[model samples]
Target: MVLPLELLQQFKASDFSDQQEYEAWRSRNLKVLEAGLLVHPLVPLDKSDNASQRLRQIIRGASEKPIETGKNSESMQVLRSAVMSLACRSPDRSASDFCHWADGFPLNLHLYQMLLETCFDASEDGSIIDEIDEVLELLKKTWVILGINQMLHNLCFTWVFFHRFVTTAQVDIDLLHAADNHMDEVAKDAKSTKDSVYSKILSSTLSSILGWAEKRLLAYHDTFNASNIEYMQSIVSLGVSAARILVEDISNEYRRRRREETDVARSRVDTYIRSSLRTAFAQVSSAELSD
Candidate 1:
């Protein structure tokens, strides 16, 4: 909470590689502050509030020309005053000592996602860093500011693992496995909460995972072979788990009908396998005729 504001006070352009780098970094932080404090603040703003208006004006001016930083700068002092005034307002009226700026919905998720990225080592070809335990412990400290609970963390971690696996050319079965394992936790969390915001995020996240998994699973004849057959189990489990959660937790139709006879995951996997095998067979026959 104080870190963002603190950085602004102590910032020096000399610390960065170049003036451009410093300016870019400064711009990003200013935008983040503006977003967290004004646009998507955890405590809603009245447009007429002087603090909100002042912060907006400062951010607009900073966008056109960088604000002078340092404790002595009048612009920095005024910016800080406006930001703190806006951030201190809370629904309970008892949180005067605390700031609620960064805890807004999508903003919180985005910040947490960036923090989670630090768990992976960029130099090691996507391997998780050795200090992950320490990094994760530190990350937990920001959960309060980010409005993240274990459930949202699990879901976000699931997405991060799956995304990392995809971005790294899908060679790391360990990443895929890690993703599938995290989905188990996410699935448990999904069953427990019906919060509208959580449900929306859950549906969107799982749908993305399911869609990616099914893309390969539904046409396995082209996607898999002898060398990479090991990936099949994890992909299948991931896809099935995502499908189960979407149907069992997010679907109103499933809740109303309560079909005891249907096995959604199993049926879906079966359909993929059958469809893929038929395609494979037809391709083989066509190849023989051409030969």
Candidate 2:
């Protein structure tokens, strides 16, 4: 995991051709970091502990270095090693600790932007999707475990951005299912702390996502409606069912609070749902007319 000093120098000297190059580089390096876990076979407990500590040290050192070089560079490999090592040890680590450690490195919104680019890159094979999913899953688990309700907005936005790459109807449906699961977890966590503004905001965002998912389901149904597609219909049914459950959950939460602010949040949710539905319907209608 400790990149060679020579490699670090090269990374400092390296320049990306474009955003795509940087994204590809970042994605490849992350994969390398994840793959590094498999490099060492099962060993003695003492030896394993030592190796793990050494890996962490290397990762930490590399992360502190200034390296924006292209993919597979030494610095990238070292940083990836650190990220994966942290992820593997997440059961013992908290999200705040992880974020604090990462804050020392150049991994803020820039890393996420690079990740988003990788997700939207169609030229690559579908493996990138799995990578994106893994990262999101890790973040979601960390946020949930730490009870970081405020981070839900960013998490939700990440999910929404990822929706753009779900080209197929089945994938869209699957994404909705995944979103439903995440939202359910978030809602459960929120319910534990009723009458809190953070919880209310989280609830409002969840409602918006459910409403958006429903519209996407309808849009997918319209786009693929050559004839009676049973799977698509099933997906739509599942989405509707999930949306109803989420909406009801948020409604009950708002009613229980009965605060003016909660009422405003509820109104915003209604507006979001209506706007999303209208946009989805318009897109479908336009497509149909063009056809």
Candidate 3:
């Protein structure tokens, strides 16, 4: 397939200040993921060979490389930019899709059970929705362990015309802000002035982590075909399940407490940070470095 002139132009002008910047630029041009539709399914690609090669290259080293063009772009750089940016155009808006799927469609029975038992919204309002940003954030860090890297390697091979394209993972931070703000607006205090506001912020933070996981896990399914989509789905179920369990167990400590929701969320997030790192090591199937 021919590289679009617009793509070339954007590539030539791409910026890179650090790892974060490099990943950001790659997400915009290479991934083409915008908006909040990360969970939607994917169509097969026309340029399987090139796209796969680029995807792997980018994931392996987007932070290290600067913007270059043509053959000089480096596979990791191109892959990082393309897969994530393209696939995650409207990630946050797609958060609702998690509930849709979790309600029981493709996910196996074990996963479905795990999802609900773990990721409940608990809003007496019954208006709970998985914040995509939260899920994406969780899934992003976790996938660094298995599913994401595996997808990269798989895509590196010629498109089997089967495996899903798990090139992207994300949750919109902007939406997270909106959710936190909304929590603030709608909250009715039961105690001190800080209680409701803190609750809102606390829940919003929890929402951000799980929301990122929700979408990142779902977005993975887009990468595969009917045959392998199920495989990716299984991974999603496990990821969300783990997140749900961890979040709920921690939430139970002080979810509705008069003034400790924020504390609980922070404390839990700290634990999660460690767990996430452990998940990373689990995904390090390539090799384990000895200290």
Best by TM-score: 1
Using Cα atoms with residue i matched to residue i, what is each candidate's TM-score against the true structure?
Answer: 0.68, 0.36, 0.23
lDDT of each: 0.86, 0.45, 0.36
RMSD of each candidate relative to the true structure: 7.4, 14.6, 20.5
TM-score winner, 1 or 3: 1
Better of 1 and 2 by lDDT: 1
Best by lDDT: 1
Supply candidate 2's per-residue lDDT for 232: 49
Backbone clashes in model 1, listed as residue pairs: none
Of 2 and 3, the candidate ahead on TM-score is: 2
List the candidate 3 regions with Cα displacement exceeding 4 Å.
1-11, 14-27, 31-41, 44-57, 70-180, 185-291
When summed lDDT is taken over every stretch of 10 residues in candidate 3, the lowest stretch is 156-165
Q: Clash number for model 1?
A: 0
Per-residue alpha-carbon lDDT of model 2 for 213-276, expressed as tens digits? 4554534534445453544444344344334434444566646664555434345346545765
Cα error, residue 51 of model 2, in Å, equals 52
Write candidate 3's Cα lDDT for 185-272 as tens digits: 2222212234343344335443544464445443342344665443543433333433443344335554555543344344534554
